[model samples]
Target: MKAAKAPQAPEPTGDPAERLRELKAGLARAAALGGHPPPSLIAVSKTVPAEAIRPLIGAGHRLFGENRVQEAEAKWPPLLAETPGLELHLVGQLQSNKAEAAVRRFDAIHSLDRASLVTALARAIDRTGRHPLLFVQLNLGREPQKGGVAPEGLEDLLKDARNAGLAIFGLMTVPPAAKEPAPYFALLRKLARRHGLAGLSMGMSSDWDIAASLGATHVRIGSALFGPRG
Candidate 1:
């Protein structure tokens, strides 16, 4: 039997609000096909100006992701003050020194990868009394330039995170470019199960529907939602 197809992103539209709606509709459909609830759509606003992000917020999207602490700090604070219920996520590599700042600024962080980071985040949480949701990033592709814990080191890291009193909410990864992402997504799901984690923060603008169908709990989306960043 043929496998069910992943949902396709809706045709591009001039309106951001329309694009947001269509993208979400596609995600919902993909989840329905898999008999699972839709993944949380994290509109990756990295490098995107606040004005461009405002329309999506105006359209009622509350979840957003950013790649850098400074950039998010520069724009999101004002937006958060003006809009209640906005959740900001840090979706990029985090510096151990910036753990406190990241915990202070983001509602969730999708890149907890090393022992030092684990210690830093635990300390940050204790000091700040802000327990932002955490995801253990895995370098599934084993890329030299990537920021996730090597798969072999994941168990030890999780143990360290737990011992340090940090609660791990999920696993996150970025599949290698130009490669099929399904196997990576599926592997992530299995790893999450092995680790007793429920959240799977994988997929992006290019393949989130496939991620959704394969049981992603969160998808980081950027260019597809905001168009090519200038």
Candidate 2:
């Protein structure tokens, strides 16, 4: 009897390609719906294989959002070295302890929700001389479990961040899973307008079009791009 053939891993197909196509379609739809399309597409590759992402890079998708610092540390350096345009953004709840590593590696950070974390990141910035763009997260959902500065507190945070020399690019937030996220996305946009800020990082795989209509400058999509994380 022939020896059993080694088990083969399934081949990946239309992943990043399909993802880009979907993203473009989404952008078009969003543009047709209301306001201008976002300028940045943050591919939220939380658990997806890095191999799949390179195809996206080849397809002209260079900005990626990693939620965890350790994973980014593991995946970003080589890809960035190989593809110079690659931009790695941090898009999850960040710990103060990780600020040092975060400031050094990420091109932008999307979770500046508290003074303590901001202080930590500022200190890290001073030590590393690396100041990644900052997005002050707002508690749009007002969810008890979520992490963001209460919307009422946004100005003070933005003011301090500006004074510290940290680039206050814009703001971000996660709407409660219970209702439509459009309101929250819109709220962020309105707040950005109020503060005269430039970027708005909202929306995800499911709600980006609404986010775009509401003036999101950056949309972080994961599942739609990677076909649901394993």
Candidate 3:
């Protein structure tokens, strides 16, 4: 035999209760490490169907994350009307053209990286007269392909965003995949403190512990919370 081929991965079965419990457990463990609750859990429901989210809604998770503006624009409206206060957030790179639709759709935009995008968002807000929460995405790992302002460039881009009338609430980041996230998480907390921002959206299912302890006001956990999306 081929050495039993390493136990096959579990199937998701599309049950939101299981997802909710998994998230709650991770949060509980993170909370146990300290005297407080994990800040906020933004369930990344990017590929998750709105039907799957019904159970999470039933289970009392009100905030969900979506990657693309068009996808969210298509999915969230009915869910929002049905759930009567559900907040959907745009957690991916947003384009300038989609800014107005995104402003109308999402309660928050987590990946505010570019000054161009910031200017677009401000213009969109002026068009719609709605101010969605914005977080400056800092490319902490400085990955060449990542879509965030360089850490060294954050303040300058933010100054421009403010000058353009964007309501920046805090910062967000994705540290180098594995390899000890604590230091990076701590760095985000330091920046938030220095700027006096009220939100620090860091960490995920894997490293939320480090993030929470370091003062992350929001944690976006996808896999450990919802299992694989595919």
Candidate 4:
């Protein structure tokens, strides 16, 4: 019997458009390694000016992520108008007060981790008639600085979201920085399975191939896709 081959990491070149192709092809290969479907790639466009992102958009990449609602509000409207079918995601810590704004601007929110957020999102959805996909962020490392719910608190948060009529499509996490991320990704997959959730939003630029191999449904790639933030 032959040993299995490891997935090749994406070669992100300096040009954003070319890098997009490289990353997409790389992710497809990686997903195949684990027999999982290719995960959606969210170009982490936070802090990247519209002009720089336009090239990638022109290259047929539509999904993007922003770290702040206000920033996204400033730049995305015109870009969205110019390009139909563009989907935006909020990948930062969202203030409960900004729920309505986020719901109005984003197609998905990857930072739903608390009861207050669930309540706010529910109200926002009611007012805006928009149901942005939500993902529960888990603090697998229990890091105090991060924005994820502690592992022990995930169940209660999910219950709260359910009660508030918020739909959670997936789980998200940022493993402890500078540590081996495979275990954390694996654990997130287990937790999502235990709860009967289907989406797994794990991995970033450094370990996206590993995340895909572990069944991540979404991988947020910033620097790898857009080059380093300024």
Runs in model 2 deviating more than 4 A are: 1-14
Model 3 gets an lDDT of 0.79
- Candidate 4 residue runs with Cα over 4 Å from true position: 1-10
| Quality of model 4 by C-alpha lDDT | 0.91
Q: Give the CA lDDT, 0 to 100, for residue 51 in model 2.
A: 90
Error of 1 at 85 (Å): 0.9
lDDT of 4 by residue, 111-205 (tens): 99888889999999999999999999999989899999999999999999888888899999998776778888999999999999998999888
Give the clashing residue pairs of candidate 4, or none. Answer: none
Which lDDT value does model 3 have at 63? 82
Tens-place lDDT per residue, model 1, 1-230, is 55445434445466888888988898999888988899999999998999999999999999999999999989988899999999999999999999999999999999999999999999999999999999999999899998999999999999999999999999999988767788999999999999899999988988888898999999999998898878
- The whole-model C-alpha lDDT of candidate 2 against the native structure comes to 0.81
Give the Å error, residue 139, model 4.
0.6
lDDT of each: 0.91, 0.81, 0.79, 0.91
Provide the clashing-pair count of each candidate structure.
Answer: 0, 0, 0, 0
For every candidate, C-alpha RMSD to the true structure in Å: 3.4, 9.4, 5.1, 4.4
Q: How well does candidate 3 match the true structure in TM-score terms?
A: 0.88
Model 2 C-alpha lDDT per residue in residues 74-101, reported as the tens digit of each score:
8778888898978889999899999999
Which 10 residues in a row give candidate 4 its minimum summed lDDT?
2-11
Q: Which candidate, 2 or 4, has the higher lDDT? A: 4
